[model samples]
Target: MYNKKSREQLLKEYQKETFLRKTVSFYKYCTIKNPQEYRDSLYQSFEQLNIFGRIYVANEGINAQISVPENTFELFLSTINQDPILQAIQLKFAVEDGLSFLKLKVIVKKEIVAYGIKSHEYDMNHTGKHLTPVEYNQSIQEKDSVIVDMRNYYESEVGRFQNAITPDAHFSKELLPMVANQLAGQEDKKIHLYCTGGIRCEKASAYLIQKGFKEVYQLGGGIIQYAQDQKKYGFKSQFIGKNFVFDDRMSERITEHVLAHCHQCGTKADSHKNCANQTCHLLFIQCENCAQNYQDCCSKSCQEFVCLPKEEQLKNREFENKRLTSLKLSTKFRPKLKGLQKNAV
Candidate 1:
C-alpha cells in the first residue's frame, strides 16, 4: 500500500535523505480508459524507486514531470515502458538538474494539459509537422514564417525564440482565440509553435490546423529538449534567458541572456518567486533589493497582510471575501490576471 504522508512529514523525509538524481519532464496524449487504475499502478512502481514529482493521468492522456535517481534512471524508464500504453514514450530531461519535487503525486484529472477546450474543437490526429531543434532554428529565420510561443506570457517573458509572437493571453484557454485572431489574415503563411515541453504545442498545433491554417509546424520537443539537443551537439542556442517551469526551481537558464526585469525595481532579472502571503500567493518577479524591501510580497498590502497573526489573517480573508461578494465581483477571472504581472515586470 502507498502511504500518503503529510506535507511536514514529506519535507522532513526529503531533508533527511540525500539522493543523486536527474529530473525529467514528459507527456503523451493517448486514450486511457481507466486513469485511476493506471495512476495507482504508476504510483506503486515509481514510489518504490524513490522517484519524486507530479503526474496527471486522464481519459485523454498523461502528463508528467518527475525526478529519477540517476543510478536507476534506466530502470525507471524501463519500468514505465513495461506498460504497453507508455512504451517508447519520449522523455525530455530538464536542462538543469535538482530536487525539483519533494514527493510523488499521481493525480487523476479531466484533462492532462487543462486547456479546457471542447473535444470537438480539434483533431489531434491532424496536428502540425514536428520539427527538430535544428529545423526549428531554420524555420524561424524564414521571412514568411510566424513563430508563436504556445505558453503563458510569464513563461515566454523569461525566455523564448527570437521573433516569436507570444500572445497576450494569460490562460491556456485564451490562447486559441488570441492566436487565431492575430493570424486571421495570414492563414497560408508558415506558422511555428513551441512550448515548455512540447505538450501544449501538440494540442495548439492541432487546433490551428482545424481552424484552416496551412503549413503549421511545432518544435519537436519544446524548449527542454531543444536545450538538451543544443548542448549535445554544441549548436548555438536561439532561445534566450531562463525557461519558466512549474516546479520548485520555477525557472531554468537556457542562455545567459536576461531579457526580463524585476516587477518592483525594474532591475534586469529573470527569477520568478511566489508572494509569501498565502492568501495572495501571486507569482511575480522581484530583484534582491525589492525582495528584501517588500518581504517577498507582491504589493505593500500583501506584505502587511502577511505580517498579521494567523487568526487575524483568516479573519481578513473572510472580510475580503464578503466585501468582494457584496460588490458582486466575480473571483473566477483572478487567475487570468497572472499574466499582467509579467507585463508589469
Candidate 2:
C-alpha cells in the first residue's frame, strides 16, 4: 500500500530503469458509489503495473497524471478501460517527458480539480459546448468570442493563447471568480474556455453559464490535444511558448518562442526550477547561467547556507526562509520550463 524505499532510493531506481516510459494525463467527471473503495482498488492496480504519478479519486471522478512503462502500456490501458467510470475516456499524452514522477500517490479529495465552488454554482449536465482544436482555432479568431485561459497565472506565464484573458490567479480556488469579475459586462459575449487537460474548463465554463453568461465553449481536450493537432494538421499554433506541467520536467516547449524571461537575469528563458536550498525552495524561472552561478539556488545567501555542516543546516533551516523573505531575496514572477528545437515541433 506504500513505497518502502526512501526518496533517494526511489530516484535512483527510476534513473536506473532502462525501459521507455510514457507520461500521460486523464480526467473524467462521473459518479462513484464508494470513493474510498475505488481509491484502494485503483492504487493496487497501478502499483502492480509499476505506475508512478499522482492521482486523485473522489465521489465526482478521477484525475491522474502518470508515467507508464512503454512495454506495458497496452496492459495499463486495458486495465483502466475495464472500469465503467473510465471506459472510453480520452488520455492526453505528454508532448515531452523526463523523470516525471518518482513515486505513486493516490489521494482522496473533495474535488478532483479544486475550483472551490459549491454544488449550486455549476451544472455539469448542462455544461458548455465542446470544440475541436481546429474548430477552436477558427472560433477564437472571431471578433465576438473571448478566449480565457482557465489555468494558474504561473502556468499561463510560460505559454498561452495569443489573445487570451489570462486571470492573475495564483490558485485554482480563486480563478473562476476572478475570471467572472473580469468578464462582468460581457455576459452576452461568446465565452471560450481552456485549461491544461480540459478538466478545469469543464467546471469553469459551467460556472460562467450559471453566472448568466451565454455561449460558453471549452477546448475539447485542452492544450495537450491542441498541440497534437497542430503537429498532425500543420496548423500554426495559436498558443505559443512552453506548456508548464506539474512534473519533474516542469514544461514542454510548444513553439520556438521564449515567452518568459529569467527571474534572476532578464534574458529570454523559460526553464522553471525550485531553489536547490531546501530551506528556500522558492519556485522561479532560472537561466542556466544563474543556475550555475548560484549552484541551482535562488540566492547567494541560501547557496552559502547549503554548504554549512549538517547540524548547522538543521539549526538554520527554520529561520533561513523567513530571513530570505524579510530581505526580499530571490525573484518572483507574476503571482507565479524547457528548451526545444525550432524544427522539432
Best by TM-score: 2
Per-residue CA lDDT of model 1 for 171-212, tens digit only, reads: 777788889899999899999999888898889888899999
Q: Which predicted model would earn the best lDDT?
A: 2
Please list the residue runs of candidate 2 whose C-alpha ends up more than 4 Å from where it truly belongs after superposition.
324-345
The number of residue pairs in model 1 that clash at the backbone is 0
Pairs of colliding residues, candidate 1: none
lDDT tens readout by residue for model 2, 1-345: 767689899988988998989999999999877989999999999898999988888888888889999988999999988988788889998888778888898888878878889999999897899999999999999989999999877788899999999998766788888999999999899999988888888888889999999899999888989998989899989999988888788788999889888888888888988777865566788899999998998778878998899899889877875786665533343113111110010
lDDT of 1: 0.82
Q: Give the C-alpha miss distance for residue 289 in model 1, angstroms.
A: 0.3
Clashing pairs in 2: none
